[model samples]
Target: MDETRQWTAEAARAAAGKKGEETVVLDVGDLFGITDAFVITSASNVRLVRTIVEEVDRRVKAVGGPAPYRVEGTDDARWVLMDYGDFVVHVFLEEARRYYDLERLWADAPRLEWDEHDGRAVATRP
Candidate 1:
């Protein structure tokens, strides 16, 4: 897998470990150059959103990744975003996920299949 997709899987696994639900990774490589992929996930509530966000941040750092270039929405924790140079991570509450509907917004982009096991992640394009 490419580096962008690999980091995306790692981020997704970390979010899943924190019980983040409806985890998804969207390949926006064709449409944008600022980043190669997006790792999106939903949490049941605000606290979980914070937890998932922190864990994902830590997981990426644990693997020697630089800190996020930018982050937003942590104050309310309703919808948090962490932007890594090659990929971005989004942790949101269910309602926010539904309302924003990023998956549908980028429906044309291919969805990447991913699985988390043994504290690691594996992924492939559909």
Candidate 2:
């Protein structure tokens, strides 16, 4: 299995645990040398959004992935950002995600196709 794929899968699983919606993995390898992917998802409520953030943090640590460089938005939890060096995961309440619209902002980045066989995601240009 590929490292990128594994990373993406871990992200998806974490998002699912918190009932994340419209989860997307963006390949930003070409744009940012610091990270390979961006796993984005939104929850319906602030609590669920925070839960999604913690779940992603926990799962990534369980896999021995590097800890996030920083985390923000705990108090309100409308939008939580986890900044891991290779992959940044964003957990947000639905309305907040819509307001930020990261996917649309980074529309040029390639969307990853999940390989359900092994719970991995293969990068591909849109």
Candidate 3:
């Protein structure tokens, strides 16, 4: 995998380790120029949301991935957005994720197949 994809997988793994649900990586490079992909997941509550976010940051950095250019929505913990330039990590409360529906918004983008059991991007969607 390329560096950006490796970083994204690490972020997803970190979130999953914290019990983040429905984690998915979207290839947005063709549709969105600002970033290449998006790693999205949802937590049961505000605390879990924060935990997932922290873990993602820690694991990504531990793997030598760049720190997020900016992090938003910590105070609310409803929908946290961690912008890392090449990709963005979105950690959201279950309700917030449903309400915002990023998956549907970017339905055109191909979903990268990942191993929820091990948190690896196992294959690209055809």
Candidate 4:
């Protein structure tokens, strides 16, 4: 996998390590020029949301991925956005995730499948 994809998978795994649910990676490079992909996941509560965000940052950095250029929504912890230039990590509370439905918003973008057991991108789902 490319560096961006590797970093995205690491972010997803980090979120999942914090028990983040419904983790998915969207290849939005074709549709969104600002970034190549999005790593999205949901947590059960505000605390979990924060935890997932922290874990994602730590793990990604540990793997030599660059720190997020900017992070937003930490104050609310409902939907934190971690912008890393090439990709962004979205950690949200269950309600916030369901409300925003980013998956539906970018439905046309192909889903990059990650191995649930290891958090490695295995294939792309059209």
Instruction: Give the per-residue lDDT digits (tens) of candidate 2, residues 1-126.
Output: 266557777887778767999888898878878888888899998878878888888887787676889988888998888887778888888889999999988888998876434566877787
Task: Return the TM-score for candidate 1, rounded to 2 decimals.
Answer: 0.90
Give Cα-based local distance difference scores for all models.
0.84, 0.81, 0.90, 0.90
* Per-residue C-alpha lDDT of model 3 across residues 1-126, encoded as one tens digit per residue: 478888898898889889999999998889999998899999999999999999999999998999999999999999999999999999999999999999999988887776645535644663
Q: Which stretches of candidate 1 lie over 4 Å from their true place?
A: 118-126
Model 4: per-residue lDDT, tens digit, 6-115? 89999988888889998999999999999999999999999889999999999999989999999999999999999999999999899999999999999999888876
TM-score of each: 0.90, 0.88, 0.93, 0.94
Sequence-dependent TM-score of model 4: 0.94
Which segments of candidate 3 are over 4 A away from where they belong?
116-123
lDDT of 3 at 110: 83
Query: What lDDT does candidate 3 reach at residue 81?
Result: 100
Highest-TM-score candidate = 4
Ranking by TM-score: 4, 3, 1, 2
Q: Cα miss at 72, model 4 (Å)?
A: 0.3
Tell how far residue 42 is off in model 1, in angstroms. 0.4
Report the lDDT of model 1 for residue 111: 77
- The Cα RMSD of model 4 versus the native structure comes to 1.4
